[model samples]
Target chain A: MKTLFDKIWEKHVVESITNGPDVLYIDRQLIHEVTSPQAFAGLRKRGISVFRPQQVTATPDHNTPTLNQHLPIKEEASRKAVEALRENCAANNIMLFDLNTEYNGVVHIVGPELGLTQPGMTIVCGDSHTATHGAFGSIAFGIGTSEVEMALATQCLLQSKPKQMRITIDGNLGKGVTAKDVILYIIAQLTANGGTGYFVEYAGSAFRSMTMEERMTMCNMSIEMGARGGLIAPDETTFAYVKNRKFAPQGEEWSKKLLEWKLLFTDSNASFDKEYSFKAEDVKPFITYGTNPGMGIAIDGNIPVNEPNVKALEYMNFAAGEKLLGKPVDYVFIGSCTNGRIEDFRAAASIIKGRKKAENIFAYIVPGSKSVEKQAREEGLIEIFESAGFVFRQPGCSACLAMNEDKVPAGKYCVSTSNRNFEGRQGVGARTLLASPLTAAAAAVTGKITDPRELI
Target chain B: MQKLTILTSPCVPLNVESVDTDQIIPARFLKTTNREGFGKNLFRDWRYDSEDQPKSDFVLNSAKYSGQILVAGKNFGCGSSREHAAWAIADYGFRAVISPLFADIFKGNALNNGVLPIQVSENFVQTLFAEIEKNPKTEVTIDLPAQKITINSINLSEYFDINDYKKTCFINGYDDIDYLLSIKEKIEHYEVQKS
Candidate 1:
């Protein structure tokens, strides 16, 4: 059966030669500081110019220091990487959003905000979180350094189609349940590997009720579940979000474009290779108990006591039948592509306002981008966070996967809003419990695991 | 330079579904800037014990099979977008990765590195896994020219779609810049025409 993913994939598949790979036309290519150096080196080695400079955009985020953007980069290797991107962009005639620039921020955040991401476009970036753009109804995903080079030199790619899976969330979401909770709940249901071999299309009443930003948040985490990418059909919410954006078609052109995008949904009887449907009310705030994102359970649920997964139990150092409630946390980190946006800050602040942090807990609130930070300050969210003993850090991918100095020490437990709670993801021997920003803030206030619904 | 042709040996069969990039090369190993020597650490956490020792329980450590081509279950190279994951897999001498599905980014990275990633039907993948389990040393042939993979006596063919430019580069062992340089004359002509 031809699913929507298959339909889109086949339409973009240029040609498939016998015993060879398919030729795919790339619509958009995004680059960042961390991975673009080698790609530029590859380009210089061959002395070739960029094939389609206008279609590609580069930014410095992964290695950009969040503490003080004005100061030069403290790490030499990171400095060189950022400099190399600047030089490469200059030489290749590519557009670059340098640090401190108005357009500069996390590649994922900047891409969507700039209206560069549109429905039905195929977007690729050097960062895996590129899937964040899939909220715009595009087939967005990450690529490697070499592939980044390939796209820079030639705006095209070689790709095989993925199987399609439909995750239909029926019914209405319970009160105080945000899109973050919905995705966390879905992750708990599917496990981390449940979506393997598929491009997931999130459907049903619950998805249709979500705002465009909430939909983006849901699609952003699709990669965490091993899906190639996640998409939602373009609807009025999507149209309204892109209407006033910078890159969206304006005036009469926008009306025409919206008409075309309106037809992007799955047919009434569209078939998928696999399907799973659940009621939204069944979902709850979830957290991970093991190293992988798949090892998730409801906030109030007890840890699984099964012996067959003994290795996981040992690594997590968790006993069977133990309730996760009141579990002491050493730290709380709220940031990353997953939950580093303005709404995420508001959610966390709402919980922490007029509250004091637990004596033993250290919390860090890092925004996704400079713009996010600006918005937070304008909303006075930072005051609420600081008053509650949360450290307000600058914008960057801070402590998400611990690429920089911000990391949880060995043997400590942290409740984080970042994606991926895999063993040692934040640091060697560090335990991460993935949660929503609200849940993380709730943990910070109580110094223990607690549901955000209580604060709401 | 001649085109890089990937010849598959059937001994190595990967049957796990959704083999994410984290499993290929974990986030902890991504701290280093070096790219040349990651093959040993490929799937280190999964293939080894907590004491940094090899786990006898892992499939890679089994003595029955060792080959260049990896035949995996579905959704290979999922999770975070670390190019090092693809590099580690390719450096580990796995020239071709056959699976029912692949993460979008990992697929691009794999192909760019000259590692052929083939996607087949679920039934075909299951049959291949079953055959490998029955005979650990069962051989499969991947003919790049024919774009077909043969297991046992049955021959099944699948096509991998790539861009025309990338196709030339892969066939000629030309990286991104090399492909572009080869067309320097054409680019110059275009620039002159625009001027």
Candidate 2:
């Protein structure tokens, strides 16, 4: 009768207070530059050290400069944060993926790429997108800095267990609809607050058919709908993806681990607190038209007629019932923790192989990690991008939150493949339209909001 | 964390729905390791113009309304797990935020800090906004032990819920990690058993 989330959570729960949060042990802890400095300072103030330093992994991502990675970072605050991460990791003897290292990338992407994110593990990070690791059937979510310190000290956290939600998407996905579009469609249909108190498990055929990278992208944005995290049951697809990675178990140990992971699925008799089913056909090449991620519509669909829609239209400089067929866009960013994988680039490149980017659009193609960048270049994807007139930037969380120099200008429209479309997220007064890489590629070549299906 | 037993202040009403953390504290301001100095940057884009001048039309800049409690619309603090959002709110002199709903991470962050996030019924939230709109000086008191929020003008009272452990922390002005450390023996024992 227990759901997969419950089974995982129950296994991790060390001690449960009668009516309070359960103290759940963490297996893998991920750290990054932005939210970890205060935590380390707190440990120092208390004259304490990290409990299990080997369990922790740190990287410099949020504030790292995307361009000229080897050069001295220019911004004082950005440079300080990156420096602080290096100093802290070195002082503590913790594993750090320095900017020069091949392992360095967004913390979320680097975790799975290195095989550090195993199925049935409890992972925590200070970044909300930690849910991306939940794609491996792990109970993973974001934590505050204090919780970061607690996890650093105890390798555990006190968390109130969330209710279970099973969102089943069946049927076949239409052409040009990527995992990014599927998630955007779900968030929009569910609204921003729909999954407020649930740990969602994506089930059914559509999710099962997705590649590991696609599943990661789908789970990455679960937090946008207010879900604590999201997960998919482990299967052959999951096992096959985890094989032969850097930190994954080798040979005999792999078979033993796979045997255990095989039982990670939800039993047919298991029940969830809530369940929602959707037809994959209902999803299209989606794009957000407002300040929030939930304010999304299909690429060829009309904006909904509502007071909130009117307000969103006002903010986005769009009109109610207006079709966003050829809405002018100033920028197109194809990277973030959300869609900065090699598969994302392949999807975008497949659409823009021979077409030059629209003369008016400033487009960027950034890989999620150094290895992803290397793999893309090795496969000639960078040449495809350059030939299509797109600037291929170094890997980091560039233009996602505009913490670096890749900010979208004020009052400009950017069709981004990032998770969020919040007001001023890319820059002050910068309007973001969330979409898939294919849709972004189409918009980049057309200089306006165009559906990838039309070009496909 | 400071003791938050009781607080009475004129309500600052922000009626906009789904106010995300990015709008609460922009990412550019998140560079500092210290939680200090975020107050000035709270709602940085909304509160300031391109020239860094205070926007006269922004709610925080209005002199008529001043309070430590902000009565916001539904789904407040809806995106990002940046505790900087809570830091900015607390530093901006807000002692509490009352809304119909709050993002789970934001609620956790608020409670960990000294800020009390009160989840009231939608009707009560609407009433608070209406009362605040009708009279800018509408004062509301949150009694933590009693778990009641009273509107002075309307003579109305509503109760809210908070976890007992969190409530204990709020009333005693205790650090959260210290509480977890109090049960360190039990945690270690369990870890040993599992291994």
Off by over 4 Å in 2: A307-309
Error of 1 at B76 (Å): 5.4
Q: Worst ten-residue run, lDDT, model 2 chain A?
A: A305-314
lDDT for position B190 in model 2: 76
TM-score of each: 0.83, 0.98
Tell me, by TM-score, which candidate is best.
Answer: 2
TM-score of chain B of each: 0.85, 0.97
- Give Cα distance to truth, residue A81, candidate 2, Å: 0.5
Q: What is each candidate's DockQ, to 2 decimals?
A: 0.25, 0.75
Tens digit per residue, CA lDDT, model 2, A173-287? 9888889999999999899999988899999999999999999999999999999899999888888888999999999999999998988989899999899999999888899
